[model samples]
Target: MYALLQSTAVAPNSLTVIDFLADFVKFWQIIVFVFGAYQFWANRRERLAADKVREAQELLDSNYQAWLVVNSAQGKGGSGGRIDALTNLARNAQSLAGVNVDGAWLVGVDLRGADLAHASFKDANLQGALLSGANLKHANLEGANLSAAQLEGTMLQGARVSGARFSAASLLRADLADLVGWREIAAVNYARLQEIQRAPHGFREWAVEQGAEGNAVSEDMSAENFSTQFRAV
Candidate 1:
């Protein structure tokens, strides 16, 4: 062995042989280290991700049970205590509509249906939450982070949604009547006229001037152009 090592060390091509073996050993070690590191990181990431999912699911189950209690009370007479309990559960449910749960940590809660009208949820953390069919009418959701939340069929009428991030959120068939731009409001007015024209309720020349609820007023046609071509129909 000594003779062989000495021959390899002193040989004319000895440098090349030493270099090749060194490189081969380094390459094999690097491959093993890289795989071990990768496996460790992957397992750690998966464990953390699974923990978050489990926590979210547990919150959903708790909220659903609270919903059942509130739902049962609908057929019976109740007082402020029931309202308080429902409010507490609503705060936990991922479907919190208009409740005053501002700045609460509510990640991944399920709040699909519950009256949250005029509730305040400003700056709440609601990522990955399910809020479908919830009534958020006139609710204060300013600056709330709702990224990855499911909001399908939710009523967002008159809600204060300034700076509220809904990126990648689901909003299929959601009621955006209050959030309509001027152009959409105009379209609604035009459709309303068409409905009035096709009414079988003897509504000849019915007009809906914007006013406080239910009170109707007539516009002065004489002050404006009376010709059919110039009519404001």
Candidate 2:
């Protein structure tokens, strides 16, 4: 091979070899870099799109829950039949916004993973309802009864809970940051309990003498105090 190379002088110049190698390496490096950038940009775009979809789904779920509560309250009697009706009604009401279903007797209803944003549930009866992981943003629950309700991991942001009864409700790990009038209700409940515990010996008689109903518990206690009265008797 050496004799043939020396005869033909086939060995390329060193400068030519170096230039060819350098250009080849530079071209390959540019190709790799371009592909890497494309892959990075595509992945980033997909992640952003997924996040937007998740956010929209959450909002839709919240509104759907509010509609279910309204229909359950209006449709009365027939037990199983009413529940079937409610199932259909909820499917339909999901198309609308800001549902109003108040004064309904909803004991032990399972509303987990529901969305209840901007719903009006004034004076609703929701004793023992399971509302875990539910979204209740901007919902109006004024004078509603939520006694013993499971509110674990529930989102109650921007909710109006004025006069709402949560006497025995579980709020563990629930989001109450945007709840309106939460502090006021807590103070009111505390005051009512203090008044009952510190009542004078003749307070009952004095209340009656002053035209206050002797049997009346505090104003906030009217809905829940019936059991208290029964226990006292």
Residue-wise C-alpha lDDT for candidate 2, range 1-233, written one tens digit per residue: 88998856645676679989999999999999999999999999999999999987875765556445445545342233333333344444442236555665556566676666787667776666667777777888887777656676777777888777765454555666656765334212111122122232453343334333334245654424532432211
What are the clashing pairs of model 2? 61-115, 62-115, 62-116, 70-101
TM-score attained by model 1 = 0.39
For model 1, residues 1-233, the per-residue Cα lDDT tens digits are 99998887788687779999999999999999999999999999999999999998987777777656555544343231344455557566445443465665455566678777887767766655667788878787776666556566777776766656554344544665554222212111111121111122322122133210112222421212212212222
Among these predictions, the greatest TM-score belongs to 2
Candidate that would win on lDDT: 2
TM-score each candidate.
0.39, 0.44
Q: Count the backbone clashes (under 3 Å) in each candidate.
A: 8, 4
lDDT of model number 2: 0.58
Mark the 10 consecutive residues where model 1 has the least summed lDDT. Answer: 186-195
Q: What is the lDDT of residue 15 in candidate 1?
A: 79
